[model samples]
Target chain A: MHFGPHLLLAALEGLVTSAVLALTALGLSLVFGVMRVVNVAHGEFFMLGAVLAWAITTAIGGHPALGFLAALVIAPLIVGAIALVAERLVLRRLNYNPEATIVATIGMLYIIQQLALTIYGPEARPVEPPFSYRILLPWFGYSGYKLSVIATSALLLIATWLVLTRTKIGLIMRATQYDSETAQAFGIPVGRVYGGVFALGAMLAAIAAALIVPISQAHYLMGQDPLLLSFIVVIIGGLGSLRGTVVAAVLIGLSDGIISMFFSPTLAKIIATLLVAMVLVFRPQGLFGTASR
Target chain B: MTDKNGFFDLSKSTLTRRTALKGLAAGAGLGLAPGFVRYSQAQSSAPIKIGFQSHRTGIGAAYGRWYEKTTAAAVKAINAAGGINGRQVEVIIEDDGTDPGRGAEVVGKFATQHKTDIVFGTLFSHVVIGSAPAAGENKMPYFVVSEGHHVASTKLNRYVFQPGITDVKSQIESMAPWIAANAGKKVTQIFPDFAFGYDHRDYLPPALKAQGADVIAQIAIPPTESSFTKFFPQIPAETEVIYHVMVGPAVLTFVKELGEFYGPNRPQLFGFIDSLEATDINSPGLEFLDGSHFWEGSPRYAQADDSVAQKAYRTAVGIDDNGAAVGDPKDVSTAAHMFGCWETLYVVKKAMEDAGYKGPEDRAKLVEATEALTEFAEGPEHPQGPKTFNGKIHQCFGIQNISKVEGGKLKVVHKTKIEDGLYEAEGDYTTQAL
Candidate 1:
């Protein structure tokens, strides 16, 4: 419990938090960047993924790794399909209008939350980690599963970056984002691109939820904190910059962990919020966002 | 009928066009003609509506669900036993969302719109405090199952009463003797940074000190925190016991992280069952708590020497021997606190019967009758344990249970006498005007 080891543990905890937050915030950034829609129900989709993971793991009934692997593959796909249906039924009808879509996603938030409550009930159920290995250091012990989460998230972020920047789908999506009318005139099928981006964004959130569910239990109200923190990351990272989102998540997560160690938890939150406010006032465009054209 | 002043012949017994139409509409709105007749005859037999302010959609939803089930079971039993004063009991539920602002609004609605006889069943201390003012303003007798010291401190108005569960001050005071003697002498406290946690933070030290045990460190974690490893370092090395009382959804994470941090080499752990009321003790990450102890208001798992009354209460509440809903093993009950809902309802029935309560007009008399209550025996009506009520503080003093986790089940290890928890009255609720 020396200062050096304590700082190392706090930093490691911060890294785990940053891993989940980056993936969740990246989803929001992707949707905002391409479709120009603020999806408020994004957090509920994350919650759905966690809940589905519990159901799947409980039903599979085998080695814990087998159930976790199955959940990792299936939960995100189901959540993506749910997001696709929602976009078609609600967001598309609103013509992706910023204000109208915001309202629609908020409605979706409550609908999904209530549905989960009705089906899963109101308990915070835990999912067994695929592996339970404690790494004992001279200073303290740590969860090996937590370290796996950081690595998995890093790989997923890199894969997502490659898909967005180095593929044909990425090119079309960027073209649509730059000018939807121009892309449509160029026979790019801009509507399909928008739909795909929305689904892909939600899938990213689901993936984050599936990975973090082992560390944190699945509860009906668990989506609330992630939603607030994701919004904070998206805003401070720059409106639609993926790089900015990841950097901001790490910055916020590390500061939160370190600040809480020195000050009372309530005061630490106040300080974090004040820091966000100062950033908004001083740099309106965010750390990585380009100035509005 | 119209009166005969030439403005429809003022006092004459003549039916005017307006009167005839009004009679026709009223008769139709009341449904079949026999329904109207039945309504008139059944006015005195109407059920007594107890408005339930529930946290159905918020952070406290898990506790709220159990409270609802317990309230329903108690009402069913009361109705089956010929009801209270020959009238069946009814519960009108209003969701409070667990927010203090919304809780106040729910109390207002219960008093004005639902027009219930009394408001009952709130658990979270902040919600209870938020709703107390509305109860006082409406002059409604509020029976809260929340074990907060707010009501017992006599800070709130006389309309509020906590007659079922003993307040947090008493519960904390009672634990010191057993903890100091059995658990450890050097205690470090870890609590949430809120009103609920403040009760433990402010009261436990003095009580422990009185028992010849000194509290070396106290760490207050924010309510919103999910991860707890970084805070563990703040606990002093020389500490022998870590007394934690964390609440909310993140409790599992707190416990899991604590397990990983210590890994079978930690201080003696003593925690309030509030942290894991509805949580399964056999959970994977919770293996570290195998030999730890917790304070339970009532034992979760059935005891070997349970009273007949306790057994009957469990059966009526639909919980199996494992303290879970019968047929649903995974759905654990909040056994520590939900018993308050059942006991409080019985208290309400006794008070109303003693006051000859007929309607809301008798609320003042009911309050006076409730204030006169002194003791409750351990029976079907008060199954948790015997209790002595302090009408002056509007609180109750009851026996407390200390249980240890053994073989994946909690076993009751100690039970504090009611006198151990009794304290001097903070202020007298009887001094306040009705």
Candidate 2:
């Protein structure tokens, strides 16, 4: 078919969406690692990244490459700075009450959405994909840009895993995750680690948003799905478990992709939601999640 | 009217460039100077602050962009012609993001902060419903290129006027007679599972029944649908025609999947105005739609009564009457938006001059003048027929009818005039048929 390339490129959107969702889940898992706070507003950070991506990109002549990367840098940094303030002000006060953290983040989500509407207004504007050139595979037409996304996500994931497992900072982060009080008593700067973890989680989400901006047009409220998808992934993979996140993300992505291809995209959502509900009822801790005490 | 549209009768007298000259001349001398001043002033002093709430990034992005681009083009043309009473129509366009709540907020900001004379756009029914009240409260003329029942509801105020009609039920009204004329058997109905899907669901049953046409089937998915694969197989072998109205990415996805599933025995497709969709007209599934029809406007087919120049514009733009442009396969939105923007801006220019509004300011007065506006030249809806928004609900009272696709684009096939109050709806299924 003459439109074979177009058709393939469209299908590639599913894969890229998966890769981006994996990144978002990575943020969720990392945040779970330290504070044990289910940051409901993690997707808000992703949304901020998308918003900033558009802002920075449009400011820079809509050159998506520089724009997205700039958002990548700026989004995480801004979110991290905000996280720092929230920690000093809000989360620090709620240390004894985990539910408070959840409530706070949920509140923050609405605030952020409203703020975005104020800043950008509600409209879907296509962000120029940082690259030009559709990669037309011989068998069908797959987008080169989507392939680029898959590659970039692969690199980021590897880099993240190495940082968490091989470095001294990684040990500190893991120790802090197990019990913040225990790690602090051992003379580790648990507070600083917490800050860093927050920054790191936010940074991953920001990166995901930057990558997603090109394919999914930037809008004020695009973060909702990624956030939901990430929550599902992190739990299914096991909380604070990087390997679990990776596997779950890919699995969910593939399921979503194939379902969308064969059935309806809406029904695929219903199926995924149902799957999550069933998993929670039976496994509770998730496929890879450690048994919660 | 079914076989030959009354609105596009080739024998009808058409206003030519020659007749338009006197108006154009008066427009140029008076129109040129103030418009030039206003336009240049907007570019130079104020950035031409025109406010827009377009759905550039959401489900309605397809509809919103056409409103944005066409309005932008019209502003460009009006500014080129002279500037509105002379300041360039500086536009502050915002993407409505396809959410009604967001739309309402954007409308508020445009009215209060941006202080735009008028706000144009938003094709989604929900978005229009959410946004229009703000404009009406502010008494700002909200010109929307949208189709929503609320546009004609009692809630409607003079501040809102649809340059295009609101309710899409009429598209069926215009097209049904033709199906009655052309088809050998009955029609099936299929649509998405949402509000629009339900709206059409309610609209077509009686429309077909009114024509004494048999209803073969009515297929509607749940509100939480992802695809139409499950429903595709149910197209009864006895069903000869299908009346459809699915939109957005779903349009391409649904049709392609259906065509793939249908193979050889696909139903003869009948549609709401959506069949004239610039997005779906020539996609992979278009072969399945070769003989399918939609009741629509004259942007695709030449209105037999239109000026030669209208046909020339269609040919020159590589589009028929549907306001669709060719070149990029997915560029229907751009062309549709550009045309709407052009027409909108031009209409504003005419209204502004007529109202004697001035400069890069006077937003309130400009809006009033726009609300005061009543008439515009009718043009053929490509892939359909001629349409004009000439009635009180701000809908096109006499100008709407049926349209079909010809030459890979939409053209006028039929037309009928229906005033807002004349239709039946106490939830009663009785209405005069075509």
Candidate 3:
């Protein structure tokens, strides 16, 4: 194949996948920084956002913006409410057992996926891409929308960083993650803090689902890949550290992009997982994790 | 578009109005013309029930929708032709969601409570395997439209039949030799870790072994897996052909991923038939697979001109009626499915007419007549295809091989018309023989 077509396609594929990877890791970072529980079902939340976006968007004449708006606005509110209820009912009773919470969230994942299948059907509902614009770069072609994913996700990432570091709610959310008991001792309503954090996490997932799904499309099973990748990102970047997650997200994204260009998709993932495992074993708390943690 | 005789010419007789009215008066109670009355009967008492289970939201939705569209069109056509021995046919469709348990439940409802005349359309292999037993137990004739080899393997049920080349073997049989003959005679395979992808990849190497072709390596990642670039370095360097068994979006992702991973600097790539999709040819990563060959038994969307029967099928189903090749003109899944259902119904109609269906109560007699059919000779539904039922196997025979596009049309590069029993298969359940 000619280099023009080859490089163009590689760039497009990398852009699509990297966008999803960054957004998914962003959610994990937000959740770990606040609730201190790895929301295993974050991918499911992403999936819900996609399905919700797809349902609304497809029903209303194939508009991605509607789905994006629906997902961005409604998904967090709904899944946040569910997270609240889940917190009250389940997480509250777990006595803060990290392992138990992890297992419970895993259960939540299957339950949600099965429920979705029950109601929506198991087949993939491919959402029409929001727009069709191919920019030809001197014998190479790239979808305008694909480039948009990167641009949009980058904006979201920057906005999230700004909110977490610059806003009042962001300060409280971080205080809760640093020390829940002390945050409560210092007059922070830990319950409300948890709710806000969960909502923020859900919102990140929804936005990612809404934005990235235009390329990968949406399906029930799509949640798993990003979920797994997000976990790797969190582990590599350092749990509960937004800055670290961002660094690792970019590193992993770039690594995957470049490696995939030279290898198969399956091989690229295998290599990424391998690298993450090695890093985890060698650097227990992750690249940026505090030694105390 | 034609009668049982396979002739579309209505030029044989031109009668005067007086003569036509006289003939109408002579056969006054025959219940034939002004077909509107018959369709109105479709909304009548008990809703002439036929059950269909399909993947409404699963991976098979594309194929499932086509099946539904074609079936709906055939029902309308049947009603126009004075439906099912004068009782208009009404199909009650259920979404199986592409899950076996869901499929089983839908079949249970159709065979028991809904009590349909026949049940048709299950898109997944495991779903068919799980639900076929129930259809056989209840003696309800089940028509499946899946590509799983397992259904053909069991051959246990007397009531279940899925027409065409029932296995993925046909593809391997066609490709292994061809890839060996070209592409440096060394092949590496990559597929999804799940049942759908694993089966084809697993089935192929053995098939290649039987064909005296050497398989370099086989790599499988999880189904619906997002990336494959990690494993690229591990691929045996001697490998030349890459058989891709990935399907749907995952396949799209894999191809795009592979395109990026393996450039012109890498070995030449090939793929399993399912991965050769025309719709995704415009995918940014598709340039990598442009010249890659695929072997499949399914009718290609970009292939040869529409056969006479296919043209009639297009007209019967409100499809464009333009051309019938895989990956070109349009998604041919709709046309392909319409042909299968249309042909199945045509065979049932001929059988019922031969056995003299007085009403829905004659279900037993209808099954017997269906069992008794020896062959179908170039009928309006089959056109150039055949419909032969071995009373022993309860299977109908015929299939079109997969094709690739050349100059905006798909053409089958392999496969020859074979004898009827060449693709014969039996059901997978015990049945009370009619």
Candidate 4:
């Protein structure tokens, strides 16, 4: 009703968007960080996750929670496994050449998109939220599911941070990221590390899709925007910096939400693009990014 | 003998030159005598090839999938009923990818590569707009089933016509009064930012104003936008009605987000079927819209008082009473907009017969014949309802349905008359140089 209340609501909406964007962008950053190969089909993996979630939920049948839980556990694993296979068969065949992988992943994008079209059909299908309850705000009531999405996404982000900081696999991944040839010299199985990181990156994207699918319908064409937005986030964050990606996601996501709420979506996009230009001009390596040698 | 659809059936045993003559006599009774006579000539009885310019692989893919099915079913029925002119009706389909440039290219392919007699079956407004000039240049009769006002607005040449479907202007004009009175007077409009959405943005205000209502806030959203919560906060708090007509792949998200943003303290909701075009109403998040109203070109679910023709058409199209494919419940029909494909095919048939269209040489004659058509009856050809075709404007005036969500199905609560949508012709396609 009042300006203050509306601003608060806008911020709340921004947080939800930021939460999803962080998970999705972190995946892209992680893949670029360790592998030095940009995955053009990352968005397709996200889309596949949502589609598989729909299929599994439809197949499982019964209480939505059961189907949703099963989808949450299975869809990302399936998507990550598919990404692993792609890395092994396609990226490995190309020797993970940067320019070649771009073209290869674009091909992968179309292949996965068409396959989803054939299997999922062309309809945007709704997956029932596992539960629905209202949380009353000062001005209006909000969906309980959205709050859960924000919470779950934050938890997933924290878990990712913990894994990267505290685990053996994370240490191997960090070593690989530091220098693949050096890591190989140290008996790290660099190729296997690349494959695992690729899979992990895809899994993070799939997890984000699985979480958001209930709010947004699963569609084959749904990948394009998220792909574009994720690219923007990664670029503005400095290509391979995970911390920068998270911070950039929050900034872009919240600004996009709040600006779109107050002014126009077109204006919001214009401002975001301008901000990207400004960031690239002043801080070419990004805020948290280390300058390359 | 007759079939379930009241079509005259010929016994397989009676197959000869005399049988063709007998079929001519039967055709006379069925008002297909000209077609039969043409068939009897026997010099050229090849199937009348209609090129279907489809959006098989883009944002419009969902609508395209259903439109393809409906077109196939219509062609199947027409072929079964002794073909269009005793020659089988063949449909040659090419995927346009729903891109405007590709749309025009597809039209060019139909004109040159396929050598289709006529090109038809494009749905998205931008695609139709992009492709129409190509049809004109190629002298191909372009019969569009798109609901965009572009055809009727006469931005397109004489080659384009939207005779089977009502455009957004007509639809909004017809329903504005009902929306104003029953839903609310002061409205907050949320529409996709595009030509199609712009039609609603442009037309609805004046139409609503005519009914003593005003649009308070007009929020234009990017068509491809998936998340919509940010846009919801922009709607004025004092707004009594939220009028939404969103398109693209994120319609479910748009509606679900609106529901979430407002919850129990929301304003009245009125939406075009575009908001939930291919979505199930009983979807968990959409329960908030239990009593909201939607404007449908045709009711998604079959009503109790559905006409016999509607029933026959539904059976032919494989859409069950619930508006899903009979074989798969989850495969929901794009029931609102797809009827145009079925109806447009019939209009094409009628025009072809009226013109005694023989081949590509008589394309001009067929166009003129289509322009001469005034009315279509509520029958198998137009299961949506009877419509009045304003051939001058190249648009149709049809019954518009305002349905409420009841028990997870749209039940028609209001139906507007053809006259409610009538307006002065924007520019006459008939007057345009052919």
Q: How many clashes in each structure?
A: 7, 69, 41, 0
Computed on C-alphas against the true complex, the DockQ of each candidate is 0.35, 0.04, 0.07, 0.31
- Which scores greater on TM-score, model 1 or model 3? 1
Candidate closest to the true structure, highest lDDT:
1
Clashing pairs in 4: none
- TM-score-wise, the better of 1 and 4 is 1
Chain B TM-scores, listed for every candidate in order, come to 0.92, 0.72, 0.74, 0.90
Best by TM-score: 1
Residue A248 error for model 1, in Å?
Answer: 1.0
Q: Residue B90 lDDT in model 1?
A: 92
Error of 4 at A4 (Å): 1.3
Per lDDT, what order, best first?
1, 4, 3, 2
RMSD to native for every prediction? 7.6, 16.5, 15.3, 11.3
As a TM-score, model 1 comes out at: 0.95
Candidate 1's residue-wise lDDT over B85-202, tens digit each? 9999999999999888999999899889888999999999999999999999999999999888999989999999999999999998888999999989999999988888889888
- Candidate 2 residue spans exceeding 4 A from truth: A1-227, A233-237, A240-284, B1-50, B83-88, B183-186, B193-195, B214-226, B233-238, B273-280, B295-330, B334-341, B344-375, B379-391, B398-434
| Chain A TM-scores, candidates in order | 0.97, 0.91, 0.91, 0.97
Candidates' C-alpha lDDT? 0.90, 0.64, 0.65, 0.88
Q: Could you arrange the candidates by DockQ from highest to lowest? A: 1, 4, 3, 2
